[model samples]
Target: MNVLKRDMQLLKNSNDVVLARQKVRQWATELKFSLVDQTKLVTAASELARNALDHGKGGEMTMELLVNGSKSGLRLIFEDQGPGIADIQQALKDGFTTGNGMGLGLGGSKRLVNEFSIESEVGKGTKITVIRWK
Candidate 1:
């Protein structure tokens, strides 16, 4: 999938998020992601996808699943071209969700993976990448 895709105005609801997550899980499993790590990757991808949908309004998301062929690790890249984030530090803080959730989305996702990175620009968009090792 090249980790890059575009969807039309999918932020209109939350159900889309569920579907997207499921798809990511299925794909990860097929890609040889360990059951345990698959869950983490899928969960993180889901949360971030929802974040992109919820926050970006509507934009394309790029995802990447990297395999070192030795189970060294896998990476997921998600990018959205919507409104950019201003305070990266504040957003990364625990319980910092701007939405109705507990704000643990980012924090929890961070704990699930070994490496996490997010970059955003005001009036631009946001990009999040998570890496997990086997």
Candidate 2:
């Protein structure tokens, strides 16, 4: 398996987001990810991509897809440059959303994947990782 990464500029417009997801889907298919795995991964990517635009106020985001050395599965890293998460714990609690939000996005996206983890700093940014097996 090979690893690939791309930088995304956060934009609220849906068309911009569609383009971003297309790039991710292309690379994911090139990696030969199984159909089921690809579906979940692509959905998760779309969610994160939208979050970057809607929540992060348009910032720089990095997307990385890797096939772990163990050869078991793929891991994806979606990182953004913004004011970072304010309340990490509250944010993870299902149905808790702050600002122009309908909630159920992140937590739901997390549940759709196998492994999910997040890191954030007050004034820095947020980095979220999700993985799915073959």
Candidate 3:
């Protein structure tokens, strides 16, 4: 197994989000991820990408392909310089949205992956990492 890293600069626009999702889908497919797994990863990518654009005002995502022995995984890290989340616990709660969205992005994306983590500062920024193994 080997390790590979890729990075994308996100922008305050929808097109960048779409491109991010497409990159995730490509990596998932190249890894031979199951259809269900690929879909889950892509869906989560879309949600987080949107969050980076809308909430973060702009951010970046790092995608890594990890291989260990017979197993493989995908890791994504989203970072932004926008105003960070005020209440992480409240933000993680279902139906908790600061915007007009349905408020399911973070929680739902967490459920779709094997690992999820978030760090944020009120005035600094935010960082989120998620991983899915195959």
Best by lDDT: 3
Q: List the residue pairs that clash in candidate 2.
A: none
Model 1 alpha-carbon miss at residue 116, Å = 1.3
For model 2, the local distance difference test gives 0.71
Which runs in model 3 stand beyond 4 Å of their true positions?
A: none
| lDDT by residue (tens digit), candidate 1, 40-119 | 88788778878888888754444455555555455666667778888988887898978899998888888889999988
Model 3 lDDT on a 0 to 1 scale: 0.89
Per-residue lDDT of 129 in model 2: 79
Task: Name the lDDT value of residue 134 in candidate 1.
Answer: 59
Candidates in order: C-alpha RMSD to true structure: 3.8, 3.0, 1.5
lDDT of 3 by residue, 1-134 (tens): 57775656565688888888889999999999999999999999899888888888888888989877988899999999989999999999899999998889899999999999999999898999999999
Ranked candidates, highest lDDT first: 3, 1, 2
lDDT (CA) per prediction? 0.72, 0.71, 0.89
TM-score of model 2 relative to the true fold?
0.75
Ranking the candidates on TM-score from highest down gives 3, 1, 2
Compose the digit string of candidate 2's lDDT tens values, residues 1-134.
66655445444567767876776677668778777767877788788778766666554434556556766455656666778898878888777887666677788779878889989887777888777665
- The C-alpha TM-scores of every prediction are 0.77, 0.75, 0.94
Top TM-score prediction, candidate number: 3
| lDDT, residue 87, candidate 3 | 94
